[model samples]
Target: MLLLDLLLMLLIAYGFGFLYYGLYRNLSARVHGRFGPSLAQSFSDSIKLFVKEESTTFGWMFYLGPVIMASGAVLNVLFIPFLNQGESLQGLSSYGNLIVVLYLMVLGPLGNALGVGSSGNPFGVMGVTRGLTRLLALELPFYLAAIGVMIDAGSADFGIIMQAQSTQSNMFAHPLLFAAAFISFLGFMGKSPFDVVGAPQEVYSGPATEFSGKFLALLMSQSAMFSFAKLLLMVNLFWGGADHLGELVAKTFVLFVAATFIGSVYARFSTVQSVEFLIRIPTLLGIVGLALL
Candidate 1:
């Protein structure tokens, strides 16, 4: 039963992730005054990439990186329940809590850093280093916000947190924490302004620059799934867990659209600028929220 539920969650996340990403591209294009590809374009590209033969120019580290990433993403999805008051959609959530989920969240990226370093491409190494540096700024405020949520609920369990918000969602009760978390969430989505990991002129591509064929395809596949898991986590934390599948889609879609529009309006920030802004605004908000709590 648990296996079946997990399988369903994985399929849903993979499908929805690509769909949302496609929407992001279309919306961003519209914001920039141009027509974009169809909503299925991203999914089609992932399929096409998977069908193609893989390149073997790199070592085992290069090959296993995406696997580890996918594993982390899978763990994340399984440990977060989709509905607040249901046994049907529960995965492995009963066995874990907020802190466990948080640790699993960063596991993939840190695991990938090993492979990115093994690639031995100067630009890739540089990109990974910058990405890790930016991660510190991204994580601090987000962690503080998560801590506030855990403290407010008086328990680290997602069920406890969701039940506590039965009367009022955290978004309204702790607006400052939500504000801090929302900003960090945008960075986590790798949206504009904060998305400097792929800065071509500044650092030349990124961690996946050297990968091609199967490896690159796998990375994209995992990225799509991973993105949805992040959305699920956010929705559960701030909006309160959904009552049904329709509600889940609505909440995540609203959040995705908001991030897409916001990302499109802003110019890309430099690495230094991105780090500094996260430190200044979101971190400050997180600290203040915690103090009030």
Candidate 2:
């Protein structure tokens, strides 16, 4: 029964994740005054990539990178409860807390970094370096906001946090924390002004430069899944978990649209610029939020 529930969650994440990725592309194209591809384009692209004939790898580590990444994304989806109060959608949340989920979030990226490094591509190495540098600043504000929530609820459990927000969601109760987290979340989503890690013109696709064919396909698939996991995380933490699947889709779509529009308007930041801005602004907001808490 538990295994079946886990599979269902994976299916949901995979399906919605690609759907949103397609939406993101379509929306971005519309912003640029061009007709966009179909909403299923992302799914089609993944399938096409999977069927391609050629893929390159640097031994076992390269092969394992996407697998590890996908696993981390799956684990994240499992650990985070889909509904605030329900046995049906809880998955493995009972076995973990926010801290565990937080740690698991980084596991995939780190594994991917190792795989990228092993590829012997200078561009990939440079991209990985930029990513790690950006990550240091990116994590600060979100961590602070998360810490504040945990402290306020007096527990690290997601259900406990959700319960505390029954009367008022954290978005209202802790606006400063939400602001801090939302800004950092924009970076996590690889939106404008924080998307230096994979700037094609500058880094030649960054950490993904050497990946091709099935490896690239796996990366895309995992990325789609990971995107949903991040969206779910924010929804659970701030808006309060959803009561039903429809509500979940509505809340996450709103969040996704906001990120997409913001990303479209701004230019990409340099690695140093991204780090400096994150450290100065969102980090300050987070600190103030924690103090208020």
In terms of TM-score, the best-performing candidate is 2
Largest lDDT belongs to which candidate? 2
> Which ranges of candidate 2 are over 4 A from the true structure?
none
lDDT of candidate 2 over 15-124, digit per residue (tens): 99999999999999999999899999988888899889984658998778778888898899999998998778889999999999999988888988988878989999
Give the least accurate 10-residue stretch of model 1, judged by summed lDDT. Answer: 54-63
Error of 1 at 264 (Å): 0.8
**CA lDDT, every model vs. true structure:** 0.88, 0.91
Residue range 1-293, candidate 1, lDDT tens digits = 87888899888888898899899899989988999999999978888888888655667887677789888988988898888888877888899988999999888888778888888888888778878888899999999999999999999999999998889999999999999999999998888888898777777668878877777778887888888988898899999989999999999999999999998888889889999999999999999999999
Native-referenced Cα lDDT, model 2: 0.91
Q: Each model's TM-score, in the order given?
A: 0.97, 0.98
| Residue 194, model 2, lDDT | 95
